[model samples]
Target: MRMCSADLNLLEKWTWNSRQNATYAGDLTSDGYMSTQQLAQAWKQKFPGLLTDNRHDYLFKFVNDQRSSTTFRAFTEGLFRAQEDTYDIAKETDEKLLRPYKFCSSWVKNVEENNDTLTQLRTFESKQEYKEMITNISLRLGFNYDIQKELVKHMYQMCRYNKAWDVSQISPWCAVFTKEDLKRLEYAEDLETYYKYGYGTPMNQQIGCTGVKDMMDFFKIHVDKDTPQQPRSSVRLATAPALLLALGALGARRDSAPLTADNYHSAVALARRWTSSTIAPFNANLAAVLYKCTPNSNLQINEQYQVLFMENEKPMNLEECRVGLCNYTFVKNRFGLIADNCNLDFCNSATKTTGLIGFTLLFVFITKLL
Candidate 1:
C-alpha cells in the first residue's frame, strides 16, 4: 500500500487526470489523485459556468441530432442541475483529463465507410475536413431525415467560388471573375440568377478617403533604445474586425470583374488613402476577414474578397457576397460615428493623433465631399 514519493506522485497524477477525454468521467480533475467525488465537489464550489454551458457543447461537439426532441428535453432537464455553492471549483486536472476525446479515429472511419450522405457534401481545397464535420454532426440525433438536402444547399452556397459572382449578390465591377466558382454557381442555379444589379454605387470615394493618416497613427511602435528586448511603451492592440466591415460594405467592388488577385492590389492601392500597410495591408486584411464565417462558402476560399458583391451583375454581388462569406455586422455597427450621408464606409473618428511632444490631435472630414 505504501510507495516512494515519485511513485506516489505519478499515481496521484493519473488518478486526477485521465490525460484524455475532457468529460467528467476522467481523472485529473484536480491537483492529483483526487477522486471523482472530490473533483465533482470542487467543481460545484468553483466553476458554475462550466456546468450549464458545456451541456450544449458536450453533446453537440461531435454529436448530431440522433435523439428525439422529447429525449433531448428530458436530457437537458436532468443534465442542467447546478448545486448550491459557496465558492468556485478550480478543477485544474480536468483540462488534462479530457485531451484524448479530441481525436476519435473510429468515429471518422465509420463515417467514411458507412455514411453515404458524406459523399453528397462538398469539399474545400480537396480536403475532407468540412465533409467530416458534416458526417460527425449527422451521427448525432435529429439529422436522420432531409438533413442531406440542407447540407447540399449550404455547401454549394458557402464552399464553392470558382466562377463569376452572382450579380444580385454583389455590386458592379465587384466580382473577381473566377472561372471555376461561377461554373459551380451555374450548375446550382440551373443557369438562373436570384437577383440583379442594374445601376452601381457612384464611383466617387468608394474606398480611398482622407482618414489614412489617423488609421496609421495607431500602428506606430514605441521602443526603448536601452533594451531591444522590450518596449518601454505599451503596444495598444486593436482588432481586425473593423477592417473586415469596411471591406465587406457594398462600396469597394466594381461591376467589371470579380475582385481577384489581379485587382485586389489595385483596390488596396486606392485604399492607401486611409491605412499604413499598402497592398500588403490589403492582403493581410483579406486573410483575416476570410477566416470568419460567410453565408457563401460555396464561392471559394482563395477567391479574392477585396471585391464586394452586387445584384443582377453576377450570381451574387460582391457586397452581398461579403455578408455571405463573413459575419462582420458587429464591426459595421461600430461605424456609426461616420457622419450621416458620409460617402465612404467610415471615418475612424475614435482616432487621436498623439505627438511625442504631447497634445493629442483630432480630425474629421466628409469622406466623399472633401
Candidate 2:
C-alpha cells in the first residue's frame, strides 16, 4: 500500500479555509482549484504593498501562464513582479544545473517509487512506542478502543497545519498530542524524510551535486580578476526534497550513522544531526554568500571569502577556513567532485535501453519461427 504523510481529507478541509481567507468567499471552484485571477488576487491580499504600483489588470496577465497548470509558477512570478524583476524561464528550465534529480532514473526506480524506501517508516508504525502513542491519543479523545491510524494521522496533520498557518491560536486537534507524543510523531516523519530524501540513500546526495556545482561556478565567475565588479545574485527555488538533497551534498548536519527504525529510542542522542524540523522545515532556505575581502599585507589582492547560512543563520564553521569566512579557492576545491556531468551520473542510458533491445530481439526470433 502506498503511504502518505498527510490525510487528503484534512488537507481539503484546512486548505479551503486558508484559501478562502486569502481570496473572496466562494472564490474556489467545486474541485477546490483556484483560477489565475483568484490566485493573483490572493497574492495581492497576502502582500498588499507588493503590487501597489502595478495595475490590477496587468497583474492578472502577468500571472496567467497557460503552459503550467499549477499556481506555483504564478506565485514565483508574483515575487519577481514585486521586486520589479523578470523571472528567467530559460535558467529555470536547465534541469541538469538546477534539478539533476529529475534525470536520475535509478533514484526514481530504486528509492522514490520503491516500497522498500519506507521500510523504516513502516517498522516505526508497528513499534510499541508508536502503538502506545496512538492508544494514548485515542484515550485522550475518550475512545474505548484505539483510533484508526488514518484518523490519528489526519489529526496530526491538521494540528501541524493549523499551527503553521496561525501560530498564535493552537488547534483543537493538537490537544490530543502531548509534548512527548508530538516529538515521537515528528521523529516518525523525520525517519520517512531521511530515507526518501536525505542521507539514507546515497543517490539523493549525488544528484544534489548539480546545485553545488552551479553555486561554485557562479562564485568562480565573480572571484576571477578579469571579471567585472557588478552586483550579481543567483536565486534558485526548489522543493523540500531538492533542499534536503543539497544539504546532504554539502555534508551539513549529517549524522555519524544512518537513522533507522532500530535506533528510534536513541534518536535524540544518536541522530543529533538529523532533525527534519530544523534542517528542512516549512519555507526552509540554504544560502552561500561570497564576500570580497580587503587586501591586507597577509591577504592576497582581490581575495574572496565565502560563508554558508541555513534559515538565515550561520550554523557551522568551515574547517578549511576561519570561523565565519571561508576562502573561495578552498571552498571550490572541497566541492570539486561535483562536475557538470549530471547526465552521465544520473541517466542510466544502458539500463534503460536493455529491455527495449531484448524485446525487439525476441520479436524478430518469433517472426523467423513463424
Give the alpha-carbon lDDT of every model: 0.25, 0.54
Model 2, 1-370: lDDT tens digits are 1112343333334434646353332122322222333434443453353333333212111112222223334333443444333333322345444445556677777777789989998998899988988888777666779988879888887786666555665566666677888778777888888988888887777777776776666666666753422224344545566667777777776776778887876745344677777665443445565555555556433353444333323434345555434555666767655645433444584253211000000000000000
Q: What C-alpha lDDT, on a 0 to 100 scale, does residue 225 get in candidate 1?
A: 22
Q: Per-candidate TM vs. native?
A: 0.18, 0.68
Clashing residue pair totals per candidate (backbone < 3 A): 95, 0
Cα lDDT of model 1 by residue, 1-370, tens digit:
1234553353344322243344432211122222222433342343243233332222111111221122222223333444333122211112111111112233223221324312222222123433443343344323553245355444444322111122223221112113443333332231111011101112212221112222222112211121111111111111122222233232333334322212223544233222222211211222111122223456543332122221111223233344433232322332222322333222222132111011111111000000
Looking at model 1, residue 93 earns an lDDT score of 19
Off by over 4 Å in 1: 1-149, 153-241, 248-253, 256-370
* Candidate 2 minimal-lDDT segment of 10 residues: 361-370
Best by TM-score: 2
